[model samples]
Target: MWTINDFPAYGSLSGWSTKGYLACPNCNIDASSQSLRSKIGYMGARRYLPENHNWHRSKLFNGEIENRSKPVELSGEQILQQINLGTIDGKNKDTDKARLDLEDMQIRKELHLIRHANGSFQKPPALYTLSPAEQIGFYDFLQSVKYPDGYAANVSNCVTAKGGKLVGLKSHDCHLCSKTLRVTDLEKLQEQIILILCKLEKIFPPAFFDVMVHLAIHLPYEARLGGPVQYRWMYPIERMLSLLKGFVGNKARPEGSIAEAYISKECTSMNQLQNENSPKATDEMWSLANGPNALTNTCLGCICNGVQFHTIDRDNRRKCQNSGLVVKGDHEDQLIKFYGYLCKVWELTYLFGHRVVLFQCEWYNTGSSRTLRVEPHVTTVDIRSRWYKDDSFVFPSQVQHVFNVPDTKLRPNWRVVEKFQHRRIWDVPELDMPEFDEVLQDDENSTIVPTEPIDDVVVLRRDDIVPQIISMEVSQSNKRVQPEGVMDDAFICDDDDELTISGDDEEDEMENDFDTDTDLEF
Candidate 1:
């Protein structure tokens, strides 16, 4: 329902006067009078209309008077393009090139000045000149040139540090350190703006104190909306409109064409929902797992009955037998040894095939003084498990068992063990545990286990529990260690700390061209 009038050009709406002497939006410094002036002179000192009235001028100068005209008005884009690539007036080729070259050099210097003034980083060449929206977004002219206690620099630092982190509330807690820091930073920013305004009145021109500049003071309040500026910007609507423009195939009847295209797309989408043969629904269910344990088509392990197991090769079963593998134990820091082959089980469902693996390992109980030989058992384990030392053993390391090898239903169900390493504790001194205590109520009908007396510590045999350390051979050298107080005499020199200077002969020659003894005075 918006019209051209509702969305007026920002420049026109701001009552921006392209001609005549205009004060800077920030410092109220006349643009034409600035040390580094604009190529297109738009701002400078001038007499008031009443002071230069026709009657006053005629009376003072006897009819002879100075004449003035409105300055040429240029669009923001035109001004920026001239600043970046220099004036592109259609004129003599050689003169234009030389002028452009000089203007380009001056523009580069001006860019550096603006960058330092705003405390922003060096902009890329592509962004040397500001776009219309970018000019409004930056609003650089509204910022104070200086502030008390280097307030401008502090505000820049605070904004740079906290801006990116304030985009979402999902990861932030209201009472946490991050949230508190943002609040304090915002307060400091507001204080700096107020301080700057108080001082700006004394330094800048009257035009600098305009309402447009004052509007900048409320930016912090706007940012407190709990997300980045882009979230509330018009970019999404603009993008959607651009997309709709592409949908217009008929130029004469563009609106009708766009509507038809949009409705047709929606109808097609609705029709696709009822079509079971469509690939979209099936594709949604085939998504792969993410993170360190992401699943792949060539995955070596699978889960069955709430337990994970690894696939093994039947041909290499003999090679994997007695292979030393590190398996997690019941205790937090405990690791156990499991020696055997890994095997898999296949099952046929109504729609898809399923595969699971089993670890056929010999359990070596290390809790006793002697290496107690526990009965061998087959159980489901994580497929990621492998031999820690040598993998070349007698039994098959991995095997793929086919289900239709006649009757997987007749086979015994794989045993699932409890995973002790799943629960992790990450407590530290500064990051203390939560304040609240968890309440655990016992069920009246549930049976409780009886407490048992502690047993004596068992001294394990050296061969049974020897620490596994992989040792590397070291080469012997004749180099001797130096005494603590001794210094290397070879590196000592009289000019060790002195800096060396290199003379530029060309620069000296250029400087000699200018006569320093000249009596010229300003």
Candidate 2:
């Protein structure tokens, strides 16, 4: 039968529009109202994760979070509410206002610091500088992919020729000849590159391992266990969990904008490498921690009782010899012991996978708990009234299609909102001609000019491919097998095709704020 592809003319029975259904005015995918509405369950809803930035960040739920706190169970209605109005906390308008205020204050503070540090030393540049082309090339040489040799020496020599001599270094010195650079130059280069790299890595990260773990847990035993349903909410849920974890100090963003850029760039390579080099743990271990046993192998279990086991020795008991087998502990004690056993299993699974499960353990333990303060207005709401009433309520009937959307089924699109074309990339404000001319007039172009050879050398290079000016094309599939620039000394791929599932990578992205040792001068 030919089915109507358009949204059902009928009103939505569920709280929000489900996949395969056209977006309703009240749903996350409501395109017409997108600018006016806040997305509730969309994956890309978190571009404003940095509390300092103005992007409307929200406190979305990871199923696990709700699982831990009974009062915070997410229901369809709550999710829909978030979608319609952003977060209950000031919504999009409030976030935008906050962002503007923060940015203004930050800019003022930075200006104040700059004035304090170098107010006297700042020199008004002489009129008549290099052309615009020269300025662009110079900036590129210093900060772009192409690295220039003898750049500093050339710059210093040029400066000395124009004026009598630079007070610091003699011309004959290699450092003056551009053989070496000042600490400031090195620091600047590092900063630029790190920013670029982090931006890249953020595109992908460890939360992606959830699907892999789910597969590893059930794949070998039940081939059909990890099909559509398991993955329906997997990607969005994982991303939501990552943000939640971050709020709780389990994940972090260090080096600010620069680190974020680097992560986005390298995340794909990292994921592939980690997956290939993944380790293995015994099945007993896998079933303990994050698996079904997470129910019994939790902190509550440890504080209360462990696990339960069963045994029989009725024949030996009849003879009063207990020869055939010996049983120890009562039912309650056995249950607690069983719980402990489950925890170990989970620990083992975590060890085998390329992940780390943060748990409280006496030996080899490293985990901390801290208060996670959400926005004052961000209050918990129910996805469904029943979900709050009975945290364990399973609403399979509320099961909606989540994973099969176009671009969504793939790895790269897991955390992206494929529906919209991003405006930020193209919406940079145009440069005012008068302001540009004035800045260019007094700029010292010679110092920034790029005399370096323009080539693809700055990017990754393959062993087999020769660099050519016209084109630099490499097969995408082959590139995945061995990414360029990865050193021969790098960690080798494990022999096993399948690795035991651990949860470290997934958790790392959730740290509240990561510590960075970025050393950049400007």
Per-residue lDDT of 377 in model 2: 25
For model 1, what is the C-alpha lDDT against the true structure? Answer: 0.29
Ten residues in a row with the worst lDDT in model 1?
Answer: 171-180
lDDT of 1 at 31: 31
Question: Per-residue lDDT of 195-273 in model 2, one digit per residue for the tens?
Answer: 3322322221212221111112121222122221212223345655655444442234533644555566579768766
Candidate 1 segments exceeding 4 Å error: 1-8, 14-185, 188-218, 221-228, 268-522
Candidate 2 Cα errors over 4 Å, as ranges: 1-115, 119-335, 338-522
For each candidate, the alpha-carbon lDDT, in order, equals 0.29, 0.23
Give the per-residue lDDT of model 1 (tens digit) for 1-522: 011221124324444322222322221212322111111211211221234433223212111242433233455675666457632110111122222222332322221211233333332222122344444333322221111110112111111121121111111111111101144345455545544543332222222232334534544544443323332345446757977898999899999989999999989978765653435444434422211222323323333222233434431222111122334344336655443333332221212122222344433334442322233332333322333333232222232221101112222222122112110111111335532221111122222122333222222112222222213322222222222221233111111111111111111111111212211000
* Model 1 per-residue lDDT at 469: 24
Q: What is the lDDT of residue 270 in candidate 2?
A: 83
TM-score of 1: 0.22
Task: Please provide TM-scores, in order, for all candidate models, with all chains considered together.
Answer: 0.22, 0.13
Among the numbered candidates, top lDDT falls to 1
